[model samples]
Target: MNKTISIIGSGFSALSASCYLAKAGHKVSIYEKNDAVGGRARQLIKDGFTFDIGPSWYWMPDVFEKFFNDFGKSTSDYYQLDKLSPAYKIFFSDDVITIGDHMDQICEEFERIEKGSSKPLRAFIARAQEHYDIAINKVVLKPGISPFELVTKETVTRIDRFFKTISTEVRKKFKNPKLISTLEFPVLFLGAKPSQTPSFYSFMNFADFGLGTWHPKGGMYEIIKAMKTLALSLGV
Candidate 1:
């Protein structure tokens, strides 16, 4: 039996949900409080220049690719993605450091700052990559409505990581404060300090230097545009 579904916002999450629900034979209607469809990703035009109100960083490009692929569409079909080299810059009170998009150059940067640290950094990222695979391929796909949703065998074995902090994990691998800060920056994307976020979430580091940063040809709004387009095409 088909049921009517009302989603309160038309952001990415809401739009994505509406697509799935509408496709599943539900009558889905998205209600947006704002004039625009995209909540935070909405673009503002001033003085003939475009500016995005929030979220410019495209940290996990693969996640976006996977989302579009699930809808029988590719990210390329909507907007072009450009990978940023020297992905980002961090400014300290004393100096500034550039983070390269690729692992090789990023590891080289680590070697330059703290000699012999690159090898351990590689090992650190390897563990982070493993965590990334587990979290992205398994954990994220599960609905969060039930505790049983997270009680899978893989998460059970990796349970120890949830008790540790990203700060602890980074400090265990690198003695240099700079190196530690660089590793911890990705954790901040969760809006939590390193000491507050779980070590298992260090997969963010892989999402950073490993997967690299990216941007659509136009701006972050392009992704919202694509998602909204997909939802509309699905008869949501």
Candidate 2:
């Protein structure tokens, strides 16, 4: 039986849910408190200039591709994505760290920071890639209704990652404070300090150096617009 579903917001998650529900043969509607969708990924226009108010960097392109793929669509169907070459730069009191778009470039940058650092950097990112495989392919797909949802074979073998912190993991491998800060930067996307975020979240490192940084032709809000368009097409 079909049911009427009223979603409370039109953020990315809400818009995505509405599309899924509507596709499942439910009547769905979205209620937004603001004048537009996009939630925190909204746009701000002023003085002949437009700016993305939040989430400018586009990481994990595969995740976005997967989301659109589910609807028989591709991100290119809506907007263009440009990978940033020298992805970004971090300025310290004495030095600047430029994060590159690929592993070889990033490894070279690590060697520049401290001699012999690139070897451990490679090993660390290798482990982070493994975590990424488990996380994006398995863990995140769960409903999250029970703790046991996390007890899968892959996660169980790497259970210590949950108890440890990103800070601990990075500090153990890299001694240079700048390098440590560069490594821990990705954890900030989780909205927590490195010392507080789980080491399992080093998957973000893979998302960073592994997948590389990207930008939608317009802005991050382009994704919101894409989701909104998809939701509307699904009769939301």
Q: Kindly give the number of clashing pairs for every candidate.
A: 0, 0
Task: State the lDDT of candidate 1 residue by residue for 3-87, as single tens digits.
Answer: 9999998778998899889889899899999888888778898899999887888988888888888888999999999999889
Model 2 lDDT per residue over 171-233, tens place: 999999999988998988889899998899999999999999999998899999999999889
Q: What's the TM-score of each model vs. the native? A: 0.96, 0.97
Clashes of 1: 0
Ten contiguous residues with the weakest lDDT in model 1: 146-155
> Where does candidate 1 clash, by residue pair?
none
Quantify how close model 2 is to the true structure by its C-alpha RMSD in Å.
1.1
Model 1, position 110, has a per-residue lDDT of 88
| lDDT by candidate, in order shown | 0.88, 0.91
